[model samples]
Target: MRIKYKMVLLILLPMLVVIGAIAAIVFVQEKQLAAQQTLVLEESLLESKRAEIMDYVSLARTSIDLLYSSGRNDEATKEQVKAILRTMNFGQDGYFFVYDTQGLCLVHPRQTELEGRQMWDKRDPTGFPVIQKLIEAAQQGGGFQRYLWIKPTSGKETDKLAYAVLLDRWGWMMGTGIYLDDVAAAKAKISQESDKRIHGVMRSLAVTAVLAILIVVACAVAVNLSEQRSADAKLTAMARRVVTSQEDERTRIARELHDGISQQLVSTKYQIELAQFQLPESDENRAAQQALEKGLDGLGDTIAEIRRISHDLRSSLLDNLGLPAALGQLANDVAAHTGLEVRVDVSRCQHKLPDTPAITLFRIAQEALTNIVKHAAARQVDLLLSSDRRSVALTITDDGRGFAPEAETYAQSGGIGLRNMRERAELEGGSLHIVSQPGHTVLLATLPLSEAG
Candidate 1:
């Protein structure tokens, strides 16, 4: 596992996860909406049927009322009631019949067996519950109600929605009901859509996962032999042992010269300057003495420059004082060395974030400011590190003669410096932004705060 491919995995896996999650969410929402639309339309149609039935019953009641009042037990009233019963086929397993409290039938269209034979002791087996409800509503006033149904003929069950009203004082109930079969049919359609969406999303996810793996493998191949080396290219692999070993070596070398030869040379330079300053100046040795004095002066200057160089190369206090102290030292040193005024506000971040994230941020700051010092010719810099309960952001700004970042040189020239910074941020699920104008360049990095323990 070379680091580049691992870094590639670190980059692409999260993308796949995000795309998958979004697709799943969209699929679910779309199915729910489709199902909802089906149910709404179904209920609306059933309600229309219910209204038509109620109107039919109203006309039947009016027709029967006219028959009773006009003294005609005639064919016109019976024929009109029969017309109303025909519209109820939409309620699949439902029916309609009209009877009086005197145990007599006014109209029972399904009662070719009982149009004239009813004595009103009969109760509807399938329609009684709904009829009883309508009777109660008519007895009370007008209102909305519900009933469940199972038709003996169709053998299908339904949840019914209906509205009821009083027809008259003749024990007649006029009302209409909506069938829920349409609701079930719509649910079936939604179920099919859900199956389709799941299949599609899973197929996409599978292809994406497979593609990511292949891309990594291919990238690992392309990344190989990137630098030609005597028919045997030496490469750094992205494995645990190699990166860790490299870091250990860097820390060791940085510590040695900082603590060892630098201090010794500084002490030697001090002694030579002291001896030269104390020598006599009146002898023929005066010119030689003056030369020794100047030599000592040059040695002192050389010593100072070497120490400065060593300090810049590595900070011994980084390992000793940890990241926060190291960052403070870096800021101070940059201001002192570059002759730029720097204001660093890091109150919300007195401790390191997650160890790896902290290291990444530190390195980013180091590289960015180093570039500013070397090339920006900036005068003032502002570094802000603010943390909340969730995330922390580090921003570095320099008031320098900023250049156009739109040009390809901004990244291509820096080679892996910018690329490495980007990789660090992406690996940790964060982002980086760069903005530059005539006299200002700002670089910002953000990551979670509480990862360092």
Candidate 2:
């Protein structure tokens, strides 16, 4: 894959994983919350339904109690009580039932065919004796029971919820039931609505996750592009400076050759010709000899100027006598020219470095000493070089008036000398560090050493 896309992935993968994990956790929590809420809602509704059914049963019991109070021992009054129960109905299929303690049906308003019949052994679809269990519930005073029975309105076996109580004085069981299919229907409806809400929440979370990921991706790409642009701009500026530096060097060399060396060479040539002309003249030998001496002096000055330029570019001692000797010569030259007290130390360095490492270290030290001479305005400078099998280190310290090392100002300082030294060190897989304060400044360069040949 292309690096840009790879970078984008690197930026987004971690965030995506975190968001995904969080979303999953939220979904699970939401699911659990919904289940809890649904269960509570169902229980609340069932409690309300239970209260309504209990009220209906209580009304029936109150009326039957009144009838028994009017004629406790009258058979006619008891028959009238049965008639009142059979007729006291609330809705379709909602009515009362009566049975003896022996499980014989006395009044089944909805299913009159079961009246006066022994239902002792009769069972529902689940094999529980329905009328027998109802008798037991009534005998225990009053409570609720669940069973399957033929619903009159639907003519199908349906779940029933009944409340029953024993009429002890009459030796009878009286009860009423509400079919539970309606309750089941209500609960199922609530469940369906709850599922819809849960689904809605899930969809909303999905959309949020997608949007969050998109935002992260956009931010990552924007940051990466901005960094890349800034880096490109820095490289471009450095390139332009390199070109300008090269041209300036060429100009300086060309001017030296033209004004100094070339002029001297021309003067020598003219004197030699004049000497040849004078040698033929009989009493002009002294003037010819003087011209020849002046020409030789000019040639000597030209040679010295050429050597100075050559040393500025690269020292011959660096190649012939190795890094230590070259550095010692640099120290001598700096002390001679700038009159700065220069201290040199190289006692620790025991191995000759490879060409690149040696040159890189030497160039850094050269730049540092040059900077000190030009700007330090101090009387003392220290040059220290040390090395072991693994690395070489050079340090140059000067008691100089220092300035703030602001990054922008340093980069725009218009001199490539410091930059060149730093680049050289970096190219050789080394580092250059500079620290400065009032009356104390240090430059240190560290380079890795290659194995000796």
lDDT of each: 0.61, 0.73
In the range 1-453, model 2's lDDT, one tens digit per residue, is 988778778767765676577667756765675577568656655654565566566556645654664436678888988998999898788899999889889998888999989998989999988888888888897877889999898899998888888988888888888887876776677667757866776787678667756866676443234645865676567555644454455446545555665565556556455545655544434544554555556555655655566566667678788999999989998888888888999988888777668766776777677767776787898888899898999998889997554455653354456666677677666888888898998888998876662
TM-score of each: 0.42, 0.44
The Cα error of candidate 2 at residue 447, in Å, is: 70
Which regions of candidate 2 are displaced past 4 Å? 1-7, 70-75, 212-453
lDDT of 2 at 374: 72
lDDT, candidate 1, 1-453, per-residue tens? 887867777766665676678677767776776677567656655654564455444333433443333333456754554465544443344555554434444544333455555443444445555555555666687555666654445655556666655545435444545556666676677678767867886777678667756766676433223324622222223333334554565565455545664465567557555655765656654654655556556556655665665555455555566556667888898888778787877777755456556666777788888778777889888888876657778899988998775555765555245656766676566788888997878888987655434
Model 2 poorest 10 in a row by lDDT: 281-290
Each model's backbone clash number: 5, 0
Tell me how far candidate 1 lies from the true structure as C-alpha RMSD in angstroms.
37.9
